[model samples]
Target: MAILGTSYWNLIDVLKAGGDGIGDVVEALTQLTPFMKDANVITCNKGTKHVSSIRTGLPQVSWGALYQGIAQGKGDYTQVEDTTGFVEGLSAVDTRLLALKPAQAAKLRLMEGQGFLESMAQTMESAIWYSNVQLNGKQFHGLAPRYSALANGNVINGGGTGSDNASIWFVTHGDMQTSVITPENIAAGVQRDDKGEQRVMDGAGNPYYVKEELFTQHAGIAVKDWRYNARICNIDVSDVIAGTVNINALLRKAYYRLQGRRSYQMEKPGQVSPGRTVIYMNKTLAEALDAEGTNGRSGADNFIRLSPREIQGEEVQSWRGMPIRETDALLNTETRVS
Candidate 1:
């Protein structure tokens, strides 16, 4: 019914049945016996992986006693001699012990070479939309200016104060595209990309899945499509800035021209280039400058301060960079069949 005394085979059947539990496999291994001490006896069990593992638990027996079939002798024969045997003999024990090893555990050299190298090619993807957004370099989202429950007050169907409009900056490394989220874009591009299906939306007009929001700039948003060579590292960046930011500025300036308006906010300290939209980037600026493509590092959470010349000529760092490599993680015991 079961191979290797039904325990291992029964374990296999449980595994093959498309489900698993620790109790079953343990019971299987428990029923198996160890190998004989005779070197020859151990050799016989080495042929199959299943039988080899079973022999480890057996009581050790002497090589000559096992094969010669000696009877009780007095001086040393009145009873079995001082020689004690272990599970079928030392040979079987050795074979059984070897069976306990993982198929590749012994080949440490191979795992370090081909295995580790192949691992680097694999990509990990993460989502940025999970948290509050950042625009350009500042947090675009403050506390979600929640409106008190008014029976019905979510994303007011395009009625709030400039709440419906926002531009975003998305960052990710991929093929045919290094980044998405355009200066001309309004909401995230992927939002509301549901094809022919009515995607759900939240109270603030955000898509529950992010790819279903109905923002205008969603069209200009870029994405690294799923592909092989490019190695789909589809890391997502989903912070939104106002697309119509300049629109408000223009409206204010135009109102002044008509001699009837005032400004709400002061222009940022610097040469204000109105020609470039909020999200616009000059290739001159985006061009990477680094000896090994390391480029310049970026800061987050904290603001970088350009201290007075009296203190320092350079911009002082506000925070450290994110870790490029992770620390050693805890080792996981092999619980599943490879």
Candidate 2:
């Protein structure tokens, strides 16, 4: 008789499960421009985050007769759902710079090790940012990709369908948050064996292994209410002030939409950051904002060019008192949509 064997989890599933946790973490080195640091960071401590939000489709009110019974409302009552979005799971950067050759540490005075650590940290941050907003071409359900501004269908065309000059993403600190399941803490000044396991040595060791604490980058955006954020797309900045394609006018229109929304309720008093709207765009779009109108004054004041200054330890630019954060993550040459 043949021996019976129970089939368990597949190897790929086992590897994925391991990657999702801290034990037996595998590190893969990837390179890209990091910009996730610019986003508002909200720390969380859960595998999946549950975001509760009220739907934008609220029921409409209707006029009723004085003596007769009231008529039924036209729209369905909006309900808040506990929508859950998964956290991004990417292995940490595991690398370091150290001279292991005998007497090499004496001659090698430059802080190459420190520089490598900084560069690695920055690269990890950028990768997280890219993943946060990037569209998943495959395995759509495996990774919880955040809402894409370009895919929102709300666009400002440049010349036509494929040419987009500028894009705008209005995001609030509450709209999303970056959570780190495992922090990128450095485990330096230690020696490791050839098998890449840490071990103590009485004296200096040759060809020492650079052992560092690598972590998994886990983050999720809780768009509890998407009304708090808006993406203005299809903006063709090169177009001359035509019948209805003025860039400056378009910007103002987008700004007011956020300002005028019932959820924003700008008229209400004692609102925090009422004018503290954050506008994120790339350098190309930033320049377009600078040249939106005939002159600086006529251009979108909220999109004007401003000098960078330290705001609460972070260097950020302010336009019309609102922060105009420049980020290359917001791609300028994006596939256009109607």
Steric clashes per prediction: 35, 8
Off by over 4 Å in 2: 1-46, 55-159, 163-166, 175-212, 236-246, 259-276, 292-310, 313-316
What lDDT score goes with residue 42 in model 2? Answer: 40
Candidate maximizing lDDT: 2
Candidate closest to the true structure, highest TM-score:
2
lDDT of 1 at 123: 9
State model 1's lDDT: 0.19
Q: Total clashes, candidate 1? A: 35
lDDT, candidate 2, 89-204, per-residue tens: 11111122222222332222122233344454544433433443325421111111343433443333344355644566665443321222221232211122122334323234
Off by over 4 Å in 1: 1-99, 106-124, 132-338
List, residue by residue over 1-338, the lDDT tens digit for candidate 1. 21232322222432342332212122221110100000011111111110111111334454474457744432211111011011110000112222333352233222222222222211001111111233222211111111112222121111123222221111112222122222321232212222222334434655422111121111111222211001101111111122212222222222222211111111224523111111111111112111112321332334222111111233211101100111111011111111
Local error of candidate 1 at 200, Å?
46
